[model samples]
Target chain A: MIKKVVASVQEAVQDIFDGSTIMVGGFGGSGLPEALICALRDHGARNLTIVANNVGGVQYGVGILIANRQVRKVICSFPIGRRQAKLQDTFWEQYRAGALEVELVPQGTLAERIRAGGAGIAAFYTPTGAGTGAAQAREVRSFGGRECLLELALKADFALVKAHKADRMGNLVYRKAMRNFNIMMATAANVTIAEVYEVVEAGTLGAELITTPGIYVDRVVEVKVERRWQG
Target chain B: MQATESVADSRLTERQIAWKVARVLEEGWYVNLGIGIPLHIVNYIPDDREVILHSENGILGMGTRPPVGEEDPDLVNAGKEPVTLRPGGCFFSQADSFAMVRGGHIDVAVMGALQVSERGDLANWMIPGHELGNIGGAMDLAAGARQVWVAMEHCTKDGKPKILKHCTYPLTAPDCVKMIFTDIAVIQITDAAPLLLETAPGWNPQDVQKLTEPKLLFTKPVKVMDLTGAPANK
Candidate 1:
């Protein structure tokens, strides 16, 4: 029998190595896995490619990894700041200095790509980036009176996510809007580790409310500092 | 031409423009408000209507900005500013959120634009010679939204016309804008061309024409929208 519970974030993240492609879930501050990220940072894994909505601001989220020079590339839609106003982001500065590489994907396209990876679908077509620079060099096809670009699936070696609650079985239920990318990311990664606020007894949590089933979750760890809820 | 004095006297404040945009929102409609001026629409959504606000970050049923003292550190908008979620509002992953957008679940999308063409093309994301260019969610919303509305000033801060015959800047989305609410007028884009639906109070058709690059059709029947009326939510 495969046990899902882990004693510490560092133990769950011990396998991550240099040059690993990782999917870090969350949008801004909503569903970020803070403890696992800190563990990865402390674990000293380098040369990583991170995929998420934003790389994060100056002192938060994935920005810490960039600040530590752990990341080598990023695949995302939005960069750090307001497009018109410009961002003083560490990642942007790194990219400008030729120390990093970036592949810009449209928001919907990025989501579908990750979803496709989790669902075992090879590739799909989307109308979201038909003619913009996002569609650059991709196959263009006309379907049902609309033009679309072919987008490929995105998979990762490890996925780290935050969930509001979990059972000992690893069935998860996320709180509010913080579930961004965590659910899909669970199935897409080779190993998925969840940092939950609390671990309830298996039968105590209803099966229907679980966002990511235990089959998709490899390990679960309780975060020492539980996230605030509905304050 | 009896030009109303107010249009000539002052520029519409950002909050005022947001209030005007709020009036156009329909009750029970799921709306995605883009960054910048459209963000202010949250404060002005009428209390009477139950318009659901969505963020590209995966939150729907978003409420107005919370007071300084009561902010939940975990909750924020696409802009990363602290916000409150409304009753029955829930969060999902980035994939699910974009599914709502690309799947056309959004009823209306209000966004800010740098320039809009007579053909309703939008150029909002990038300009030539910028340091870094990232579009965020505007491209998806513009391409997938049921109805696209632009909320911007009549002219650039340097007094350049934004509504043009053709956008010289890089395009964000082609032929996407259905209506434009500028400080000086409300214009509707149809298959034929831009129709002058209404002029700002105290401004005449000619005054609007002078500031607009494309030739605007001064249709005989036009109304000056009264912003003082209750917002859609109210």
Candidate 2:
């Protein structure tokens, strides 16, 4: 029987070298592989690139890594928190200080880019941000009289995804809105490490219920962490 | 815009403006609400309309904010605020979510605007002084939604016009706004010009035109805004 289950979160991320591009899965507070992130912070890898939807709150998942001076850059949709929370967020402070670099992508474009990366599509034109500042320094072509900006695919060295359940063979299923970026990030990375709540025997998870086929997942580790409300 | 007590009496409150926008929703329509005043629209949706709310974070059929103590971290709207899921609600990946939006499946996208050009150009995602504001999903919604409506204050604080002949801020999308609901007036954007549809009870076309930078066209009969269920006039 083939098993992709790893022994521990630390061991799963131990081989990640410095300057690795990692796709951290979470939109705000949900679906974050906190254990793996903590392990990555402890692993002390330097000059990392993180792609996420939001810059996590101060001293939180991605924030902790930024606080540790481990992250070199962040590519995300919304980098700062709400108006009141911006002053306290580490990414905002570091960004204001020019200590970190960022590439802001419109949320939908970011998602499509990851999907394109996984599907082996080189690049595609999207109507989003066609006339905005996001179109600056980018190629734009008119289709049916509507201009579209060309966006390139994005792939990472590793992906840390949180899942509700996984099989020994690494087939994964996600829950609720937490599935946001995890599904595409799972396939868009060279090494996809899934932090699941439960790992069942192969063939135990119904084939129809599995959203991510085992072929895309390279490693699985069970990390039991309760959902903590972000608010 | 922060209105003084006298001005507030004549203008629609945030809730009232949201209620007016809610009146525009059609039954069975798929609607996406941008952050801010647009998010409040879900609370005022018509009882007869069953509008399916879409959050770019991958939820469709989104309900209002969860009751206290029932908040689930995993169930959040695009704003990252905990929201409940209505019956028949479903979740998908962000890619699939954007496909629903970019594919023209969404019927209406209600957004908040910093400035709107007379030609219906939108500039809400970023401010000129702020170092490149967050784009989030505004661009996709502005570009792909079948119809775009803006819900915002008519003018800036200290009485500066927000509706202009041309947007000075960065554009979110060009010529996308179909309708605009402001505290003082309801306007519809046409190919030729913006037509004044209705005005608040205490205000008239001339008063609204004074606060607006662009030229306004009046309908044959500009109706008084229907502020149903709004607080009784002082």
Candidate 3:
């Protein structure tokens, strides 16, 4: 049997080094790998780059890493809402001070970049950021009357994803919108570690239900952490 | 440009502005309402129209908030607040959701703005000097939607106009806004020019132009946005 199970979340992420780029999957707290994130924070890897929808709030989800000052960069959509208007006051303190770098991508562009990395596409043009500051750099081309900018693919060294269920062989299934960025992140990373609620035998997860194939997953760690609900 | 509000009542609250935005929604349109003022639109939508609401976080056909005790922890809009999904509504990945947005499947996107130029430049994502900024999916929606509409206050709380000759902030998208629904007026953008189409109840075209820096063209007679359910004329 090709073994993919890891003894613990720590062991699963044991190889991550400082400055390693990580793609964490989730929208807000739902479907986040809480155990893996907490483990990463405990693992004490500094200067990490996080790619997600956002870091989430202070008391929940990836905010722990942000609050701990472990993150060096974030490539995200909205890092904070309008309520965090006092920007220098929150996790953004480092960003404003230039200690942390933020490469903000439009949500669609971010998703497509990750998907492109997994699919082996080197670059593509998108109209999302055209004619705006987001389109400031690189190449701009006109396609059928609409101008678009070329966006490159993005890949990560490790991807932490959450799943509702998984099989020992690593086939995975996600629940609801929580699967937000997990499916692509799983394939876009060199080492995809899945934190799942339940694990079954290799064939237990029906072929129809599996959203991600095990071949893309390098490790499977079963976790008992319930999905975080921001609401 | 197609339709202007016929109602003459002005003291348009956030809810009232939403009621006017709702009037523009045609039945069977798949709409995405941005946070802030745009969210109020769900409350005033006419009951007869069947509109499906889409959220960037991967929900479609999402309804208004469930009653207090009925909120579902896992069910929420992209904004992270509890929302109710109508029957036949489904959830997907954020990638898939943005594909729908970027792929041009969404019909309308109603959002707020910090600055909108006469040329339809949108600058909602950031204000200069802000510590943190996130553009999110608004750019995608602005670029990909069949039509993009802006609902915003006519002026800032400090009495500065939001509609200007040129946007002073970072742009979200260029030449994308089709219609602007403001508290004091409804202005249509035609060939990068603002057409003063309607005035609110108590305000006139002069009241709107005084605060608005851009040269306003009084194209076509002005009317008022319908505010049927608005708080009884303030």
Docking category for candidate 3? medium
lDDT of 1 by residue, B1-234 (tens): 235445546456667778888987999899999988899899988899899999888889989878867777578887767889898898877777888887899999999999999999998888879855677888889999889999999898899999999998777778899999888788999888888988766777888899999888878867876756633322
Highest TM-score scorer: 2
TM-score for each of the candidates: 0.92, 0.95, 0.91
Candidate 3 per-residue lDDT over residues B77-108, each given as its tens digit: 76777778887788887888888988889999
DockQ of 3: 0.60
Tens digits of per-residue lDDT, candidate 2, A1-231, equal: 788999999999999999999999888777888889999988999899999987776456677788788888989888776643633556666778887898989899999999999999999999999888878879999999889999999999999999989998899998888799999999999999999988988878899999999899999999877676758
Better of 1 and 2 by lDDT: 2
Chain A TM-score, each candidate = 0.92, 0.94, 0.94
Task: State residue A26's C-alpha deviation in candidate 3, in Å.
Answer: 1.2
Model 2: per-residue Cα lDDT over B1-234, one tens digit each = 223446556788777888888887889999999888888888888667789999998999999898888899899887778898989999999999899889999999999999999999999988787874788999989999999999999999888999999999999999899999999999999988899999987787999999998899999789987776764333
- CAPRI tier of model 2: high
Worst 10 residues of 3 chain A by lDDT: A81-90
DockQ score of each predicted structure, in the order shown = 0.52, 0.82, 0.60
Q: In candidate 2, which residue ranges exceed 4 Å CA deviation?
A: A83-93, B1-5, B231-234
TM-score-based ranking: 2, 1, 3
Give all candidates' CA lDDT scores.
Answer: 0.83, 0.88, 0.84
